[model samples]
Target: MLDIMAIISDGIGGGLKSVLNIAIIVFPLMIIMEIAKDLNILDKISDFCKPLTKWMGVSKESAFPLTIGLVFGLAYGAGIIIQSAKEGNLDKRSLILVSIFLVCCHAVIEDTLIFVAVGANGFFLLTIRLLTALVLTILISKKLPSLDKEK
Candidate 1:
């Protein structure tokens, strides 16, 4: 009984520790993102992404969250994506394109750095991921119906 109690306690402690670690990362990221948004830095990033997004056949609305997800990771980008969708900023086709792109290649910088720490070639990995995401997003975006057609 004592052993069982200790095991249960350890499990609970581990779970709480994991949650705390996640909150530590996520909260700071969110705060920084909020500040960037307010400072219009996010708009600049979105503007920089416009040509890439145009090549992918998505709108400028999708570019902002897509750029954020590409740089910061899904947890950071998801909030903006949800807000944009709720506000009807992105059309269905653009949302679909952005979702697929993010799924394939979100967290570019962090994930590449992590893999590099484990002896992977960060440049090669980043290139492959970016290329795969771009090609797939472009192809899928072409296959999907246009927003105007939906309405």
Candidate 2:
């Protein structure tokens, strides 16, 4: 009976504990995203990607998604592509190429640092990941037909 009561209590309001938990998770994320937006950090990220995207055989417009992958990793970076794809910003050909790149790997900065901390062979892993992704991107481009017929 006591356990049931406590579970019910937690399910209902849970008072300050719930509020504190929400604040702890949300506040920092909101603040960081706000600062990032104001600082035009995404723009800087895109700028750094311009040359790489071209070399990848994708368009200049592709810099945005690739840069996102470089900083944030596959999920968030691929989310960008999906969102943009839905909004019709990206053609299917480029989307596939970017998707292939991200699917093989995205080098998250903090994760790489953690890899280094464990005394792993950092550059070896990084090199293999990048090479695999590059190869997959090209293979997908060669074999698959473009989905975006609009532009």
Candidate 3:
């Protein structure tokens, strides 16, 4: 069975390059994120984001994790959230809601660079992505249903 699987995989020749590229790109990014965490840069960024998060009905403590999620990807951001959750800083409902929003994902530099490299109106894509994130956040908060049931 394994031999058959390998043979099938071999049929997709050019597709194999994408797998290698994905691994190369992701591993370095993960390492960089770890370094940023160790350096307390993430903490500083979270502190900066607190006020905005507070205004949006999330705890100030949520700022950093959400920032990580936005600047990295859903996995990295959720790693932060999971830590916070383990420490009892975030409740179940808030984490769940935040995950929904954060899964939309962002990359601080790479995404824009890709657009510029490809000549796809980089600024336009960036503007739309940013606005969409902000608008969706506000809209979701407004549309949020009460998770708590009154006795």
- Top candidate (TM-score): 1
lDDT of 2 by residue, 42-78 (tens): 7997898776676566767778888788666788888
Lowest summed lDDT across 10 adjacent residues in model 3 is found at 142-151
Report how far off residue 116 is in candidate 1 (Å).
0.7
Q: Against the true structure, what is each candidate's TM-score?
A: 0.71, 0.64, 0.65
The TM-score ranking, best first, is: 1, 3, 2
The residue-by-residue lDDT of candidate 3 on 68-138, one tens digit each, is 88777677788989999999898665676677667654674466555564456877887887667666766
Give one digit per residue, the lDDT tens place, for model 1 in 1-151.
Answer: 8999999999999889766765665667668767886898967887888998889988777888988898778976788788898999987788878988899999886677656655689889999999999999898887887877867
> If ranked by lDDT, best first, what sequence of candidates would result?
1, 2, 3
lDDT of every predicted structure (CA atoms): 0.82, 0.73, 0.71
Predicted model with the maximum lDDT:
1
lDDT of 1 at 13: 100
Runs off by more than 4 Å, candidate 2: 1-38, 149-151
Query: Least accurate stretch of 10 residues (summed lDDT) in model 2?
Result: 107-116
